[model samples]
Target: MLATIQKQQNNYVVKFTRPLSHSVDAVWAVLTENGKLQQWMSNLEMIDLQKNGKMHFNMNDGTDAFEEITITDYVYREVLEFDWGKDSVRFELTTTSDGSLLVLQETISELTNHTPKDLAGWHICLELLCDLLNGIVHDEFPMEQWRKWFVEYELLVEDVKND
Candidate 1:
């Protein structure tokens, strides 16, 4: 399944799930390593995939905007957990009848109100992942799509808050 944003538990959640023919090791390698991640995701550095390790992303303008990310839990080829600041996010992998199922859940913190931005970012990221797995090297930044989605998301959030 492609990544999507949902309202859950009074907060926003962004999730992606897919079944792949690749081995769990291969998937984990792509997700944990910096070079491999950049193949699909952004050019991110300072990512430590081990438990209690720190992970941060670099901005487009070469500035380091640090987030207090911690790898809270990890089990080889099975589960990975981390934090986006105080928010908890997890990646769970499971063996399915066909191949492997990968699920990513990003929980938004109540203190933050940037659900629209988060939704847009995740939509692009998941699209990139789909392209990467399919061996397509196309640029996956959906800037126009993100902007459109962000507007709708913000409107929805406002409607929910007022109800």
Candidate 2:
């Protein structure tokens, strides 16, 4: 499903919600554990997981350079929020009768041409994470799917701006 992008106060929030038929622990592992996280988000490595700790975002551009992302909030199996450049990305989990509901919200200080790209990238990542939890694995990142989502997010961003 496409994420809901809305302008809230001075910033924009792009939220993706997924209800998975897996335990909260399972989904939490996929979001934080290095092995499972790499399957979906290869560029991120959790260096220090506690609040005020750090995560490394590898450039992966052959220079071996990386940006240290700070963990702004942490609650075991419940919430994880971190700094994403100037913005912040948060993950919240809640248990349901069937399994769990995962909510990912990225707060953007300003909407730019690049905002849609980041939104689409995150859309793909969440989909990949859900698939992994369901025992589905893709050998490579699906660029085609990302491209499709990018166009949708572009339109959504425009609407938010017009509003």
Candidate 3:
């Protein structure tokens, strides 16, 4: 499903919610554990994993690069928020009767042509994470999925601008 993007007082909020048939712990591993995280989002690596900790970042564009993204907040199996470049990304998990609800929110400081691309990336990442939790493994994110979502996000953001 496409994420909902809304403009706020100072920034834009893009949220993606997925109801998963997996325990919070199981899904949390995919969000935090290096092995599982690499499966979904390979650019991020949990370094310290605590509040004020760092998330090792790699451009993955062949510079053999290393950067640290500060962990703004952390609560095991509940909440994880971290600095993402100039903005931030957060994950919130809630238990449900079936499994759990994963809420991913990205704070956009300003809207740009790249807004849709960023939102689409999150959308794809969440879908891949859900698939992984359900025992469906994919060697990489399906580009077709990302391409489909990227266009949707672009239109959504354009509508916001028009309004």
- Please give me the total number of clashing residue pairs in predicted model 2: 0
Q: What lDDT tens digits, residue by residue, belong to model 1 across residues 27-140?
A: 776677777677766645436667887776655566656455678998877887877656777888887776678888888756246766775676566567666766776565
Cα-based RMSD of the predictions, in order? Answer: 3.2, 0.9, 1.1
104-140: candidate 2 lDDT, tens digit per residue: 9999999999999999999999999989998998889
Between 1 and 2, whose lDDT is larger?
2
Task: Find the candidate with the highest lDDT and give its number.
Answer: 2
Which is better, 2 or 3, measured by lDDT? 2
Q: Against the hidden reference, what TM-scores do the models get?
A: 0.76, 0.97, 0.95
TM-score of candidate 3 versus the correct structure, residues matched by position: 0.95
What is the alpha-carbon RMSD of candidate 3 to the true structure?
1.1
Supply candidate 2's per-residue lDDT for 89: 99
lDDT per residue (tens digit) for residues 1-163 in model 3 = 7788788999988888999888999988999999999888888999899999999887788897988899999998999999988999999999999999999999989889998888888888887787788787788668898899889999999998887
Between prediction 1 and prediction 2, the one with superior TM-score is 2
Q: Model 1's lDDT to the true fold?
A: 0.69
Residue 72 lDDT, candidate 3, scale 0-100: 97
